[model samples]
Target: MNPTELLSLLALKKAPLVGDILAKKLIREFGSASAVFEQDKPSIAALEGMGDKKASFIENKTFLFKKAEKELEFIEKHRIKYRVYYNDDYSKRLQYCPDGPIIYFEKGKIELDNPYVLSIVGTRQITTNAAAFLEKFISEIAPLNPIIVSGYAYGVDILAHKLAIENKLQTVAVLAHGLNQTYPRNHEAYNEQMMENGGFISDFWHSDSFDRKNFLGRNRIIAGLSEATVVIESASKGGSLVTADLASDYNREVFAVPGRVNDKYSIGCNELIKQAKAHMLTKTEDIAYILGWEKKQDIAIQKQLFVELNDEEKQVFKYLKKADKELLDIIAMDLQMPVHKVASMLMGMELKGVVKPLPGKLFTLA
Candidate 1:
């Protein structure tokens, strides 16, 4: 984008109470960010969701525009690349998000055309088991050549980035702060390697101070960039869970690796499964199956067909084969089996590689 247009966007970003949604609205209505700033107060306030209070902020050109100028100078000096929301290079999945940033800075060679992208996130206090699971999971998915997205923070986020590097798959780190400096300081070790394939991205300005609250904004980018978000491990509450929720809000698939009930980090994953917010992820194949990453011919139906199924399990399987998919309750009702019994039967069948569970309590033949 030209400096004039970029400066306008930076100014829009600086406006108080003028978030991404509102800024984009103004831009769409005015035809350009520069035009949005040209509108009179009466014109700006005339739009829905805008009023005197909001208009005042947008009209604060004396302060907001000056800041934008300084930020633009920094961008030029650092030679950073930014993706405008309407640009072709912007994240395709993220562009559809209503609250996606109008522009975000990126460092490194990031290719958005990759067919598969997944975000792995979790608590900073990652457990040994979670780390082991991530290693094996990344290895299994390496053949698919998927892009990995994550926060560059410690624990699962850093682990996900490093694992993607080790597997030779591109990895993108969504930062909570600007590219002016790396947070945590210690992670500078991986910066050179990350830039080779994936790289760092953020919407924060060079002058923006790092804060705890920034993660919420950063997490949205991670969630928005991928077709699916996986919660490797999280406590009952954390930024990872927030990312999972954002992914669900975007109508993207979410998967969580289950841990023992009492495991602190497992609490979030179990709750997501129990609440039906995420599909239960047990093995790497679960992701492939749910995402339909595998071609029909690759599924070895012969092996599954030969796997013996009990009478009730066979009944469910037959119905599922005829129908594309079915809900858990519907299967129970149609088969005249108790819901609990059907649930148990389905679990056993899933283990036998004859059934697969989907989000929203749905099931399908594996």
Candidate 2:
């Protein structure tokens, strides 16, 4: 069979060991996927990590081709969009990651070039506080137009996606299952709305199913795909703490919204901050500030927020507030007692929803 028919057939049959690792190994050792197809017995056997069990699995080109034909037939018949690694438009970032998908299936329009991309993750069973915190937290960050990426799973993942779309922001769902079907089944309508706004992506083909291991694979994609990762809530296991781990490994900023110490779901986030793997934050401002965007803050806003501030926070806010303020001057100046008294009042006012903590410590007359 020709190469076109051969690949399709392999895909349709759900050929054993045809996953990304095997495909990468084949390309690395043989120098080309087509070369592996024509390989002599020893050359094929010499492929690292490919023992006889895997070697024997691909001998059938015609039969597998027939099955692959059916799979492609299924996708086209059902209208699923497919993207192969060799394709020009494959995710530019994933192509470099060792753990990236073998193939990606995109169902609708997907745009990942947003100015800011964030991923907020956590456990399946979340807290009332975590849920409430996320609602308030997202509302504050919504106007910024962030492209949020998450697993589209039960807890924080779905919550992030739901809030992003509900607020009219672009939201992408990185999936664990194949594009041929949406897993957890309950998210069908939400999934549809996302495609219209943010869209979804999966590394597997139609033959792939949502296995136990696929979720971690999903997590890495989420981490690598986003500019920053925020862990709203997590347990000792599962959810987005693992994604935070991946984000750090990938050299991206990691953040966690702190929850009460006693909560199990929040334990991972707290541990991450304790270990310095992530920064602690309550709102998206923490991320924007760390990313060096505070430089662009309005000066009038900066003056009110920074001029009367005291101590370390004052210094930091002052440095951030003005275009030029020596750190030494900040260290030397004594804070005003009235400012402290005003600060306490302001904190209360802000918490009461009467005012906001604007950039540069500027508080409007809310």
Candidate 3:
């Protein structure tokens, strides 16, 4: 984009109450951010959801442009890279989100063209079990070469980035603050290594404040950038759950690792699975299967050669083989098994590469 248009977009983003959705709408209606700035008050107010007050705010661009100009200077001085929402280089998945930022800055060598981008999030106080699971999960899924995304915070987020680097996979850290500085101070150690392969991303400008509320905005970017979000562990309340909710709102697939009901960090994940908001993630294959990444031919080979199902799982396999696709309830009833028992068997069978889940609680042989 030209410097003139870029300045207008930055100023528009700084405008009070214009926000991402309305800013995008204004740009769409006016053909460009510069055009929106050139429009008269009457024309601006005439747009849907716009009023005299908002039009006035948008028209009063003097202060906004001053801030934008300062930010532009900072961008040039730091050699920071950025992506505009309408550009081809911006994240394709994030573009689908209505609230996605119109412009986001990046640092280091960041490439997001990978077909499979996965966001993994959890509590700051990650448990041993969750850590072990993430280590093994990243190693197993490394062969697929997905770009790993996470908040560059404590616990799960930082660990996810480290593991991705160790596995030689691209990993991007979505920050709550600006790319000019790292949060938590201690994590600055890994920044150099992370930027070598992955990098840092933030919508917050160099001048933006580092505040608690910024995390919500940061979480949206995390959720928006990926085809799926995985919650490895979370308490009943946390920022990771917020990311999961945003992912769901964007109509992206969500997965939660099942854990003992009484475990503190497992409560949120259990609730998500019980409420049917996310799939029950038992193993690495579950993600591949649910996202349709596992080819039928590949699964067929695994099923024929590697799978060794127990009696109950074998029963589910036989039933699904004949039924083609069957509901969970019907499978339990027809097989004279309890619903819970059948569900458990199906989960185990799915991990074994003999069964796959369909929409509306249906299952079929893989």
Candidate 4:
């Protein structure tokens, strides 16, 4: 955390092939990043995965340290804030990821302690349907006050941030480049507003090139920072799907909205669902239910009064009110609805606080 220790971390991060995983291992073994630099070549090479060749790169500490010092100057000059992986303020979910960045920089009033953090991503080329879905989804989920995480690219990513801001929720934008500059330039307009509530996060240095491959690293951060990652829409091959895979790899929940079979952007999401890689996201409740998010006790009673139910939900609500508590199957039969449809309605209603699920698959008016 001190200047010297931070310089060592920046230098270690700059070492070629001495990535986050290996850097963390060395830090753990030596007790600190500064200590790692004090070791002789033999001592460094003796560690697992470090051979003579890799040790040689680490031995050239002078060059690495000079680069790090320049970065340190940049940090100081710009007043950018950073977090080491082991720091208490670092993201807890991200800490669980083996390959998470050793240090990431930020610029804004960002808060990661919020209990509900979600990473929502999708195709850069957004579709009307996907946009509509995100708008409604964020609005419905706003009361829970989740921190929305997304890449600050065009289309779905930017839209998600805008919606989060509109809903008065904190939204963090994970950048592929550095905080020194915004990638698309056009998105610069949102920077001030974003920082006012949330802010930008990146592991890339100011000197790092804005290469296409950097997105893989950025996607991992997005995935690691949240309890769940939702793919709003994606083409057959895109970054959002990659984030979903990374989230799943981290043992975090992944939700993908199903789209029309023939739609181009829907292919990736559909494949994710078909392969059982992601949950089929139909309604907002699916996220709340799967994540086991409970409503605040103070608002539980009032939520029902304000929730607007559709005709189908109205029917389910009326039945639950009359029956008090009944089995899912009985409710489906009594309402002349398919069991699946009724179950779906129950999940949505449960989210709205209009209904509550009881033991043995029973449902009742809340």
Best by lDDT: 4
- What's the C-alpha lDDT at position 141 in model 1? 77
How high is the CA lDDT of each candidate model?
A: 0.89, 0.68, 0.88, 0.90
TM-score of each: 0.80, 0.72, 0.81, 0.83
Tens-digit lDDT track for model 1 on 1-366? 667788999999879888999999999999999999888989998989989888887658878889999998998888899889999989899999999999999989899789889999998999999999999888667656689999999999999999998867899999988898788789999999999979999999988877899999999999999999999999999999999999999999999999999999999999999999999998888887898877532453533534666667767876786676999999899889999999999999888877889999999877
lDDT tens digits, residue span 1-366, model 3? 799999998999888877899999999999999999998989999999988888887657888899999999999999999899999999999899999999999997888888889999999999998999999888667656689999999999999999999877899999988778889899999999999979999999888867999999999999999989999999999999999999999999999998998999999999999999999998888988889876633645445333566667656765675578999999999999999999988888777776789999999877
Name the best candidate (by TM-score).
Answer: 4
Q: Rank the candidates by TM-score, best first.
A: 4, 3, 1, 2
Kindly report which residue stretches of model 4 are placed more than 4 angstroms away from their true locations once superposed. 295-306, 309-366
Which pairs of residues collide in model 3? none
Model 1 has how many clashing residue pairs? 0
Query: Model 4: how far is 360 from its true place, Å?
Result: 44
For 47-135, candidate 4 gives per-residue lDDT tens digits of 99888887786668999999999999999999999999999999899999999999999999999999999999999899998999999
On a 0 to 100 scale, what is the lDDT of residue 89 in model 2? 71
Which candidate, 1 or 4, would have the higher TM-score against the true structure? 4
Model 3 spans with C-alpha error above 4 angstroms: 296-366
- For candidate 1, give the lDDT: 0.89
Please tell me which model should have the higher TM-score, number 1 or number 2.
Answer: 1
